[model samples]
Target: MTTICVDAMGGDERPEVVLEGIAAALAADPELEVLVAGDEGVVGPFAESHERARALVTTEVIGMGEHPAEAVRAKRDSSIVRGCAAVRAGEADGFFSAGSTGAIFTAATLGVGRIRGIRRPALATALPGLDGHRTIALDLGANADARPEMLVQFAHMGRAYAKVVLGVEDARVGLLSNGTEDAKGSELAVSYHEALAAAGCGFAGNAEGTDLLLGSFDVIVCDGFTGNVALKSMEGTAKYLVKQIKAAAGESKRSAVGALLFKPALKRVAAELSGDEYGGAVLLGLKAPVFIGHGATSATAVAKGTAACAAAVRGGLVDGIAQALADAS
Candidate 1:
């Protein structure tokens, strides 16, 4: 059985949602083995009560809200650290958490470490654009700032991730900017675009925020600061649009009838727009696969994230990344 480690105590909702996710994951993958690291007393009972959770899980509870590094050093018992340790020790094939992004990144960097020659790890998230095209964006807050060289590295990393994970061959990489012209972006974007172009990457010119939904490129590379802002903006806009649609539907009987008539189709469309439907973002460039789920993730979302991690392991993503970096170096 492929083993997966989960930070059972992490998340805005804490043990309840995390536990719910774990239980749902176990239910979906009967052969999957889970190592839950959190407060044992709390998580054990929850896991035991669920047949799939109990049958498939092993437990080790750690403290909640402890400083990440200190907890990693001192609280050999903190959930995030323990989960990373499990993956590092080969007890788990991958790690999943809806925990503090800072803690997860810190613990993983220290415990599991980066792939050879990778300067730093990056967070990669796939956002659905127009035309059923999914655009993958990288450095989504892993490294708030990046060098031109780092952006070049991100291109290679994003390319490989899109290829293996998203099954997109000949993935196109774009430099995010305010305009399509080479002169339109910041100094870094212009320099990086030139560097990427020269580096033999499939660099598809500049893509503005407006082009984000146009699917102009398969991968978009930017420093985390820009990427994070873009991500939040998109998420907020999506939420607002959904709220507006619901409100509009509730305004009159005619709208209510229309909502019922199109409810199934609307549900399908909503699922596609939801961030969780893409599973979760991958913490690429690490030695082992790590998926960071949304803090408000439901059981289905967590289960899907776990399955994505399993696919990463089976597809040799970590090893592929190491080789790609080594070749580029």
Candidate 2:
């Protein structure tokens, strides 16, 4: 059985949303077990009622704005730290949190530790692709600055993740650049492009920002600074478009009627573009599977995110990445 340690006190909402999501996740997977880490007074009762759920009482909680490394060290008994410690202790196969991204990354790196030979860990998310397949993008916000060698490692790691978690065979990888030509982008992009091509890991050359949703490549690698900017921009644009569509739909009686007629299609489109549908971002290059969800994540998103983490563990994601890196070396 695969067990995942969950941070019951993490996220904007407290133990309530976390417990409800855990119940939903447990109901969905019969063989799964959960270890809830938070204050015993809150999470203990809820965990007791569930069959396969257990609670590990933690006294402290990590604030979202705290310095990641400092908080991890100072608050050793914090929910985030304890949850990661569970994985390191072999009590859980993975860890899931909708808490501070920086804190979680720090805890995971220090507690469960990084895979041998990995310079840094990356946060990868599945983006909706035009080809009916999800494209994997990495270094979402793990490191604001990265070297060309790190980007090359990101490509290999992203390829392994796509194959294992997304079930894509021979995933194509591309360097995210200003243009498709090798001459475009900064010096880092140029160096990465040449290195990846020589590495021969299904290099698809360079891809522009427009290619992200076009499914032109199965995996795209870039420095965290560029990747994070692109991610937030797309998210903001999606929200703006949705709002505009809703407003237009209610502009007039005739439009309302038209919207009613196409409500089903519109709902489908909304789900397709929703962040919850894809769960949360996966933290790659760790010793175990770890997923970080949005801070304001809903109960449904939590359930889906936990399920995604479980799937990653079952799919041998860590082993796959280790093997890929070994082969590349």
lDDT of each: 0.78, 0.88
Worst 10 residues of 1 by lDDT: 54-63
lDDT of 1 by residue, 75-95 (tens): 565677777887889888899
Cα lDDT of candidate 1 equals 0.78
Report the C-alpha lDDT of model 2 over 1-329, residue by residue, as the tens digit. 88999888889986789888989999999989999899989778978799999888999999888999999999999999999999999999999999999999999999899999899999899888765877899889899999877887898899999998779988999889999887887887888888888887878889888878885789999989889999998888888987888899899999999988988987777666665677789899999999988888778878888888899999999999998899999
| TM-score of each model, in listed order | 0.89, 0.96
TM-score, prediction 1: 0.89
Question: Cα miss at 4, model 2 (Å)?
Answer: 0.4
Candidate 2 residue-wise lDDT at 30: 98
